[model samples]
Target chain A: MIQISVDEQACNGCGLCVKDCPMNVFEMGSGVSIPRRPENCMGCLSCHEICPAQALEHQGVVPSRRMYISSRVCSMLNRVI
Target chain B: MTKSFIEESQQNFQHDLMFRVEDVPLKCNPPAAELEQTLHGLMQMNGYIIRSLEEIAGRGANAVTFRAGKKFGHEVAKYFQKKDNVEEALRELSYILYGQYSFEPWKPADKDHYIVEENGSTFIYLVFHDCIVRQTLRRIGQEQSGPLCQTLCGYVVGAIEEITGRRAKLEIVHTGPNACLKKVILK
Candidate 1:
């Protein structure tokens, strides 16, 4: 079960997420982006990543654990950060 | 009117280019049963190696996995070099990848929408509706599988290069938990 929310205050209805989503999960309405088909969301995070305003919120979506980042790499990144 | 010799030859060539694994030669000419068993075993080993490498190398594992996938694709192209057309070779390759490697039921994007042709250039669009890598990532609650997807890119590019004797470009156009679309352009 994927839950998607749009921040009307931040979203300018750019529709980038609507265009970027392969599943057609977002729709533009009243100059704002809406999660019209939240049920079809695959939790790919493409919308979240593409939203310039960072106005989209996804809940109940399990984060992917396929990161190949090892502890050594994380330590190095930690030091850099 | 009788068909011209060139037209007849073209038809014959198309017929010969039909996708068939049997057309691919094996180093050891194994029987069908034995070949399937060998492929299954090889895939199992591949999965193990990928997992182990991901665990060992961490961030660098994707490069290794990409190279491995490219090598695998090159090997397949070497075995099936009848026609040098990139589209035909890739279509056949997709059949094998989806039929063999997918852990869940797979549905291909509509063919009419899958291919884009313009100005004598060919672009193939593929959507993996249910990828094993994404499934694994989701199950484990990890946020980064971009590297894993790179393996597919390498494999497709390698196969295209080997088949057409020319390099091709691959782009990950869109990715989702349930679907990802990859675009391969023949250059």
Candidate 2:
């Protein structure tokens, strides 16, 4: 399982990551990208690479995709795997 | 007696002016080294002295934050290595600088590379990252073309340097043609 962590301090609340993500793994809320569906992450790193703030991290036995944003936002896009 | 009175009045005026306004020199524009030097100067002016260069690099942020008072708060700065390694990928560094405009404001439009935002006194968000063009290259492969790589490399390096006044070295970790791997490293 991949653990995605967005650095609150680093995420600037830009919605680019949410827009770039093809899996719909991220969504914009309170000016930040929250992992709406972590399982939906294709591990393509689209969100991770696109994030301007470099605020995403994925830590696990197999690190897949980590998207870090620069702000602390409400997680409104969550859905069960 | 008149001369003495004039001199006293002049002193009183100077003291009053000093109390009324604090003159802080703008040190935003300068080379990386020079900026660090100016930061040191500001610290000394604030009565804190630096002992060595390593100390400056290691804790320069703290010294700067301290001297700027409440006018400036913590801001993040990132650095990258210059090499052609496929393993270590570059990550974007963004953060909010807590405080009012103690330093000059970096306009989001002006910062075409990174997305910069200021939400009142809450924080200033600076978005730093590469876009699809560079990511496409990275995803496709490293040994694709020198011109392409150089251009991409220059963009990423230039963006960070312009923002932080620091130098960075970039490495191309992998070169894949979006097909079967031509070359593979065992690391």
In terms of lDDT, the best-performing candidate is 1
Over 4 Å off, model 1: A1-25, A31-81, B1-60, B101-121
Q: What value of lDDT does candidate 1 attain over all alpha carbons?
A: 0.66
RMSD of each: 19.1, 21.4
For B1-187, candidate 1 gives per-residue lDDT tens digits of 9999999999887754466766866567676545644544454555566667778898788787678768877876676654465556766566546633332111232234445667876777655554555544543445434556667777767777777777677777666654565677876
Q: Where does candidate 2 chain B have its weakest 10-residue lDDT segment?
A: B178-187
lDDT per residue as tens, model 2, B59-151 = 454334323321221122233333222222222222222221011212222235222223421122211222222333343333232333333
TM-score for all models, in order of appearance? 0.48, 0.26
lDDT of 2 at A9: 80
Error of 2 at B34 (Å): 43
lDDT of 1 by residue, A1-81 (tens): 679999999998899999988778888899999998877665668789778999999998655433222455567999999
Q: After superposition, how far is residue A70 of candidate 2 from its true place, in Å?
A: 31
